[model samples]
Target chain A: MQIVREQDVVPFRNRVKEFATKIGMSLVNQTKLITAASELVRNMLKYANGGKILLEIISKNAQTGVRLTFIDEGPGITDIKQAMQDGFSTGKSLGLGLPGAKRLVNEFDLKSKPGEGTTVTVTHWKNGR
Target chain B: MDRIPILKMGQFLLVTIQVDLYDRLALNLENDLINMVSKTGARGVLIDISAVSIVDSFMGRILGNIASMSRIMDAETVVVGMQPAVAITLVELGLTLQGVYTALDVEKGMELLHDKIGTIEHPEDEEEEAPHDDID
Candidate 1:
């Protein structure tokens, strides 16, 4: 899904919720996943001027998880570590988007190059460990 | 431009959010509600969010901002009917919504608002009123 404007955020969230529900994710887990997706989608729109999101469902053994990858080609983060820290924001926000998103998912990965772009991938397991 | 309606009931303003709020709509609500409070001189604000399914940090901040703004305007804000899942997600998102009041439902929220403003008349007290008081 391409998230290029503020209006796109809601549809992106609905898509994420649909995917999470398809996997029979618990309400709590689904909410967490969707909230994390909302934060990332808004971040992309805020700092990166919008981006594309990829959703996938993966399973291993008896556990199923939903994974989302947000790819943005706008301004990238120079210091990913600082971006992941709480109370750090370049925008006029509460500075909880990145770190808060990380806490909601089971796995979080971020890659950014100052001139290239930024990509964030988050995964939430059905029955979280 | 879609807008959320803010109902004025006596000294209180009521907002029932029945749709999934996009960022823009949420911001607009924050703006409109604050303006309404100031315009009407409302003493309390009640937001019923039972239909809302998810709340991220931005939305959470918006709610907190509304509470803070209303506080400065001398109006108490109560967020009612938060879904259990949304509440859990909010905490995980590191948004405790401090300084905001919350209740389980709209009725309870209305009661809380009345209690906060000291306007609720007991049922027994109403029953004890003399019949001559109804002449007006």
Candidate 2:
């Protein structure tokens, strides 16, 4: 379990990188994971108030991959469906956080409520790893 | 036109540029990136492209340039918050960036900078002579 505090984002990144290294993710996949992880982590700070992230590596024989989970406790998203749509961001930057993170990996799932916060999970196969 | 100019934020370097769909500006962005990377001697970069809505093939090429530039500079670059709609449109237009580093927002991008740049302990760097003047 990796925890990201309100003001500390660098530790979270190093933690994620360390986590990826332990999982034996290839350089390519590691970069992808890093990119995806940062995106999710950034969203926690920007949209949500703050949150913690959990990264778990899963392997089965010839197949190896990573599972990322982000849980944020904030005001929660008002529109998850619309948020998933391309070009839909509540901030000034181009609205590609969720969707771009989704494309980096093989599997992605996100859940959020208006007042319940947001939880996101993503997985990338070793082939895609 | 003059240089697009590079803006530095302590450890984070930024270059705010506008380019046509042609490959010219995109290539220029690449060259400017090299100069900025040399000058700042920082570990990472945050490219905030919130103003750009249209991403052409030339724009797509910028990612590859960033990736290569980072490697040579012993630094890393992370593009933050590019428009997702532009992403889709670029891909649909048969454009792709094979190797690139990207983040969702500035916060996370900072995190990456820390991870990559944190190893430097500058106890002697201030006293040492820099090798290049190309950075300025």
Enumerate the chain B TM-scores of all models: 0.87, 0.71
Candidate 1, residues A41-79: lDDT per residue as tens digits?
Answer: 999999889989999999878789999999999789988
Task: Give stretches of model 2 more than 4 Å off.
Answer: A1-7, A60-62, B1-136
Report the lDDT tens digits of candidate 1 across residue range B1-136: 9899999999999999999999889999999999999999999999999999988888889999999999999999999999999998888888999999999999999999998989986878667764545545
Instruction: State model 2's lDDT.
Output: 0.67
- CAPRI tier for the interface of model 1: medium
User: For model 1, what is the error of residue B48's alpha carbon versus the real structure, in angstroms, after optimal superposition?
Assistant: 0.7
The Cα RMSD across the true interface for model 2 is: 11.3
**Model 1 root-mean-square deviation:** 6.1
Least accurate 10 contiguous residues by lDDT in model 2 chain A: A1-10
Q: Using TM-score as the measure, which candidate wins? A: 1
lDDT of 2 by residue, A1-129 (tens): 444453355456567667667766665565566566656776887777567677777876677777888898877888888887667778854466677678777789998888879999988776673
